[model samples]
Target: MLKGKHEIMLKTSLGDITLVLDADSAPKTVTNFIELAKSGYYDGLTFHRVIPDFMIKGGDPNGNGTGGESIFGVSFEDEINADSYGLHKLKLGDATDEALPEELAEMTQKEYLEKQGYIFNDDLKSLPMEKGYIAMANSGPNTNGSQFFIIQRKAGTPWLEGKHTVFGKVTEGMDVVDAIANTEKGANDMPVEAVTFDVEVK
Candidate 1:
């Protein structure tokens, strides 16, 4: 372990998530999220876009895709989710296999991680949203806003290898995360039942 890092436990309505904060790899990115998440900006928000077998997208405060920080506060100069870093992220077609059943996803993510070999258990302590990784929303490069997503199932979005800025991954409570993704959507792809969200970190 190079340095000591703190842990954050995000307790969502769907379930709970225990994540290790990465202060090195994506310092600015992490700082932005930690600040916003702790400030209660993401609380009570719904997963506006929930694709059952693909990914769940949300974080826009307005419940609309266009919702988020009006002013560009941070540059998505990401350390990961770039078009490089040599990652083989799942794509649309890859997610066809029953969507990895969110219940076992947290434990089964090892297989996906092993295939990429980017999963290092050392104490490098940095944001690595490799495979089954989580990332912020970006209309384009370095255009991340309040939106984010978790690759619940594998897909064929190889081009997405370095396109999205990945900041974290779902280590636990992936099943619940899946539940949120599986929720019925309305006309604008908004959750039918309004699957509310709340995060807690310990």
Candidate 2:
């Protein structure tokens, strides 16, 4: 797996939050983030979307969750390694063809997986979308840009595993994260008072 060491400090309006990036799982995504952080691209950006028990999202140039781009000035493909999360194995056996849905009965394992729209890589190790994890926020497949979100739900959001590229996790200041999440929000889950921050790569 591709790996590198990267830690960043987010000096937010509320407090500081520290994150350690996992380049082994998402090298390109981490690289993009570090580039943006170093260039001050994320300075003074607001966490545009914040759900109390879900996540806090930001890094959008528009500060509305609809705008942002990578250092390359475009969206990039998702980095999802199914093996690390055990999402590569097919749950149903070939012997169960008779009981399977008509459309799936004749398909091979790979075909079935492709039909389900799961793209993965054997070279990388994708981390799960758990509490405190940081991930790219995209509209859909391969649409990743500069926007990102931090998981807040204590049990985690497993449903997002294959959908988003998880690049890092909170290493300190989770209470600051908690406070940011619990802040009063209005339209589009935006904090009534904007929650902006400056980030530093370490």
Candidate 3:
């Protein structure tokens, strides 16, 4: 894992996971996470959404993937780009005109994305959404709150490159993540038994 100024110990019901956060690439997002963790905001939060080959998501006060707000009491913009982590060229999502809003239909993908408040940072590269990487979970553009996910897919979810903000990676205890991924899940991939975690900033 990359060396970073911020590290967090996530003590879960399953086990402990140590994460190293990159504030260089994602300053505001990292700051938001650290402040939230320090404020006891993530205590008792359950990993509400767990997919076997995907990720385990949590930090929702509602514990149902629909709640929690940032310390600023508002959503924040994404600090990422379409090309990073060795991805040379742009590999965009389904940004075809038909899939875009009517107002964005005539604009280029870059224009549409920028219009939605996503800033592309070329100087500081963001980490890929691969195994052990930790990132924010959002409903859409700039909607990041307290929700976050840990990547479990060893190959990584490349399609998420330009979408989510990957601020850190697990430096230890990935077995704990694997164990949580194996937990039985019900509707919406919600764990049948609650899997809770607390954060300790270091």
Candidate 4:
């Protein structure tokens, strides 16, 4: 079982980047990530998506931003900080502008939100989605798998707060992340030249 915090070293073709996973805050997600790394699941996986001002994403075995699975072969719920949302706030900042249904106000926050299709696993500390922030990428609520991304810009991405699970932070080598993010890319935001990874959990 994972205890306390853990550090992961990601040796990329661009450079080495170090990540600090908050196992206490996101136990399941952190465990999944560590297991994947230890099994060499991320070896040779290319950074399939890169947006200069946003983030760099990878962990897709197919290297095309299309394929990957959790060690459990099932999707996991998000570990988000509920406090990030003010007690009275009702809507998310995304394009959907999804808001709490008035009819479900009587239900608890978790129940009401789950009824709305949000699946949260834990209510831990919230990490600002600023540069170097690392988080899982999902299609929607509770779809977290192997795909993950590192925020590349210094500005905070408020729209992402509470929407995705922020499980780790880049404790060192942000410059390497910036380099990968700034690299040339072809179609589908894929790097023109492959930027592969060698992940290790320590």
Report clash pairs, candidate 3: none
| Residue 65 accuracy (lDDT) in model 3 | 84
Which lDDT value does model 4 have at 166? 84
How do the residues 1-202 of candidate 2 rate in per-residue lDDT, one tens digit apiece?
A: 3368688999999999999998988998998898888899999999988987899999999999889999766888788875666544544355364587766665545445446665667788788889999999998878889999999999899767667889999999999888999999999899999999999988
lDDT of 4 by residue, 1-202 (tens): 4757899999999899999998887888899999999998998888999999899999988787777889767678788765654422543232344564555544445454566677554456656678898998988888888999999977857667667788789999999999999999999999999999899887
Q: TM-score for every candidate vs. truth?
A: 0.68, 0.87, 0.85, 0.85
Tens digit of lDDT per residue, candidate 1, span 57-76? 77778787777862236434
Q: lDDT at 83 for candidate 2?
A: 61
Best by lDDT: 2
Against the correct fold, how does model 4 do in TM-score?
0.85
Q: Which stretches of candidate 3 lie over 4 Å from their true place?
A: 1-4, 85-88, 91-117
Lowest-scoring 10 consecutive residues by lDDT in candidate 1? 117-126
lDDT string for model 3 (1-202, tens) is 2235698999999999999999887887898999999999998899999998899999999989889899767687777855564334322334432465555455555555666667677777787789999999998888888899999988888767667999999999999999999899999999999999999998
After superposition, which runs of candidate 4 have C-alpha atoms over 4 Å from their true positions?
A: 85-116
How displaced is residue 103 in candidate 2, in Å? 3.2
